[model samples]
Target: MQTSTGNKPFSCEVCGSAFSQNSSLKRHMQIHTGEKPYSCEICVSTFSQKAHLKSHMRTHTQEKLYSCEMCGSSFSDNSSLKRHIRTHTGEKSYSCEICGAAFSQTVNLKSHVRTHTGEKPYACEMCASAFSEYSTLKSHMRTHTGDKPYSCEFCGSTFALNVTLKLHLRTHTGEKPYTCEVCALSFSHIFSLKSHMRTHTGEKPYSCKICQSTFSLNCNLKTHMFTHSGEKPYSCEVCGLSFSRKSAVKRHMFTHTGDKPFSCKVCGSAFSLNRNLKSHIRTHTGEKPYSCEVCSTSFSENSSLKRHIRTHTGEKPYSCDICGSTFSQTAHLKSHIQTHSRIGIKC
Candidate 1:
């Protein structure tokens, strides 16, 4: 028996789509007709094809008929089971024409191809922002609506997306799933783990256009760009003092608010900024991390270490305005200022 090759034997009546076989044309007609002849017995849900109905029925029944012999993992369908088997076998049949990156499934390869093409099909109606995936666009919509649908049962914490909620749950559960293959150092967030990976690989993907300086994280590169632009958007409303980053402005607020959120666990010592708290912790631990190159003297704080370095170098940074006399510290220069005054006074 020979298969028909000259022309398409069947044609769809609804869409005028030609097919090689009558069965393909029949399946194509269901798209335009919206006819779902096959219905699941367990659930009220229906599907266009019997094969789809069979796959849907497994969700209600929780039946995993197809089992992998290598990993002992099971899947509802044979197609999913075949895809899972490829993970163990390292078989990637579907590949991208642009990048040549291979995937086990055609769907995954199609998604990867969009990266090279820069195709953002999913667009937000409220904003002009477009995303590569529908799920990303869905998450972006939450920002405009101020919708936090995902809520934690334990902490009463809310998140815009289910994936963010999943990550937040790890803080309570202490679940660090993303681990470094090199050192087994784990992080709560996937991005944190990716940032930590740069230490091992020495990879700096983010770079500054101004100085050509490289950074491991994109946010670091963003902050570095601000230094070149001399842009301080994050500013204090009261003092008119500005910072390149929001976190810097947040730390500066403690000067007015007198709020000390960061506290030492060992001692009851508190500090406004996290860096101050970290420096205070060294007092308890007796950890002098900053060491001088000239002398073997070590200091807990970096500022103290920098001041100490001037002793070895004999660098007089502070100078008198009236005379050419210089001092190592600012306090010494302030004392010298009184002698220059008509009436000598002490502050």
Candidate 2:
């Protein structure tokens, strides 16, 4: 009756949130103090309120009290059941003010707002890392703990996160839900689709602070950062040679195995890398896609075009360590180094 009459006499001292009962006010105070008195014996999960602990206990008991009539899905709580029903109705009441992105849950809307505000409330205790979402922080903790709780039923493969396990399951199912509107190409992951979209849009959002070099993918930008840091994390087991990127390490392994998997359909020529095969194909088709801006000269390869541009710009990027002599190309630098070797000088 007090809740309906807008009479909440018991007010919180910290947040000024009013409650009808004094017991409810005491539970609400735990939020400000970061206190969780109630804990689950099964999972060691803590909750501020006893009702929350009771709700969590249903997970261990497998006692679902609420059921969705639309899909017959059962939930431990009525709030969870209501959230699940939104999936069928496609109803999103909560919305972001900045981007106008809608979410069914208020918690999701709060999480989305962090993207605009750049707020990271949940911080890692082990490492110097922070996350906007508490769930993301929990996932980050697994990296330090080396925990792989989520496992695949098909392949028996383990993953640190449930979303990663879902992505892995798509490999076995061959389910490509994310589709491109421009090319009709499909991807299993949303991130893969977003990266593929850059190919059509010509967008290079990821940029290196050191060289100002831009990349379409964050992974490519991370690999570019290795050049600045001189960090080679990926190492080949056969040759013991290190590379900045994992793909580069894989390509290096092919040299040791003498495995040329990528073969040209035109001339029966084989290459270790698919990009090399694509460049080799241009030679047969007489396709010179790379063009010079100044002389209008065309080249089959981008590297060749870059070298050609150096001729016009008088830019000698490759420099000799011994004599400090600069050359337009690596081949020119190698030829210059040979001169030093012939003259009894070590380079």
Candidate 3:
């Protein structure tokens, strides 16, 4: 039989779809036949195609042929190399037309688009709770299954993904390559440096339309919106207590489980939260970036500097109705009004 040049010779009669390659048409037929010809020699595993078997072989061989020319970083496959190229080029072609926010990958852009459209394609089979990504839905399934595949080599601590395991490894290595140019502050990851950069630039790009308040991080903005909406999606299965943030729920779980993973090396002090440990480290380093413009006084923390700024601005957003008096700090106002109230109800 003579094949037409412009026509699709291979077609799926079941779905009424056309394919350019005969191999693709053959692969499609496997859905009906349940045939897996390509089997792994190492294990009792079968794949529909030879290409899948070839890619799976690289996991056992640890053969990373594709490498980044700029950093000499290597990956096992060409697809990973293509994805890593965007980090060097800073080319975020996938953009949201609604908010003008760009993402490095199309999948991330599609997830962001769901925020505006309120579309959730991936749903839990156990519950009606939905997610934008299939990976998130898979992770959600683990809550029900109690499956933790990835484990730390040093410790027996298990995680969901290999990338998370790699991030956790940095804590043991004490390798903080991502450094700030202005303050010389180091971070374990590039994303942490990117978030810290916003503090120096004072760039709050993520803004709430309803409240007109802005935040440097999207996660912070989402948490802030919860204050207005009163939406607590993450709930405790044990006690039924809910939290807007996942980290809050994690910390709450620690309260129930009595888990304190973060510890200080200098004094051997333990902290429930990692950020509390980070703040405690600042006391040892004497690294105070937040400084006062009015006075030469500097503070080790941003919150202290924010309180000091109110003294210069003389702007007391919080007021006492009973005493008709105001103070710069909320703590100061609460203390001052304690003299007026009798039943521990300070004005």
Candidate 4:
């Protein structure tokens, strides 16, 4: 035969693909013609070749004839087993023509090419949102359907995506897999690691369209949007007060419960918030992280440094409505208001 003799004489005029026999060339021409003669009876799935349909039938039969020698992983088809073997072999034969990025699978390379071509074939019917990958579009559909397929084994929490469930599991396991190279600090989630990195780089990618105020994290930018919109979603059940943040609502609950969860070991003092405990610890340690550039003076808290900066700028924001008098500090404004009350002033 011509195949054994290293000859492919039958060539197609369309793509110039040579074949060993006329029958082989005729089968190869079906690719250019967009023809799939073979079809599965069960699913009605069509294939260009008979071997592919034979492999598709195995899925209906639940048959795995081919298996990996390295990991004992099974596949319905031999080509799938070969692709699975590439994971062990670390063979990335497929490369992106534009970026030269390599992938072990042809499917991954095709997805990568879409990044260069700006091709988003997969689209959601609910929101008209598009994605390059079908898997991503499938995940986006969960937002509309309210379907959480992935559930945490440790806790009873459910997530729409498997990756979110994996991140939630780390909270119980106390696993800090992602680490910062700059500070040697660790985080459970990759997003937390990325946000922590922005603190060092001072990179604020998220910007508010209204005020043009930028934030390092997207969550912070979303929270900042509430300031512009005057939207406070989180409400306190105890006092019926609303807050822009859930953490503020949590801190408000401690005021009602009188629960000082954060405790200072040095002075045996307690605080409702963790940040308050951190600030209290700095008093004992004499660690003034916030410094004034004008007078070279330092303070334990950033709020104290901000108040000190107003002294240099002479910026008195707090003003009395009755007297039209302004004070540099709130304590001074309160003292001034007491004078008005002592003099039988209605204000």
Error of 4 at 61 (Å): 2.4
Superior by TM-score: candidate 2 or candidate 3: 2
RMSD of each: 7.3, 8.2, 12.9, 4.5
Q: Count the backbone clashes (under 3 Å) in each candidate.
A: 0, 0, 0, 0
What lDDT score goes with residue 43 in model 3? 83
lDDT of 1: 0.88
lDDT (Cα, tens digit) per residue for candidate 2, span 262-335:
99998899999999999999989999999999999999999999999998999999999998999999999999
- Positional deviation of residue 6's Cα in model 2 after best superposition, in angstroms: 17
User: TM-score for each prediction?
Assistant: 0.59, 0.58, 0.38, 0.76
In candidate 3, list every pair of residues with a backbone clash.
none
Cα displacement (angstroms), candidate 4, residue 122, comes to: 2.6
Better of 1 and 3 by lDDT: 1
Better of 2 and 4 by TM-score: 4
lDDT of each: 0.88, 0.92, 0.86, 0.92
Q: Could you give the candidate ranking by lDDT, starting with the highest?
A: 2, 4, 1, 3
Backbone clash pairs for candidate 1 read: none
Candidate 3 has an lDDT of: 0.86
Local accuracy of candidate 3 as per-residue lDDT tens digits, 112-202:
9999998989999899899988888998888888888989888878987667888988988899999999999999998999999999999
Model 4, span 123-242: residue lDDT tens: 999789999999999999999999999988887899999989988998999999999999999999888999999999999999999999999989999999999999999999978999
Worst 10 residues of 4 by lDDT: 1-10
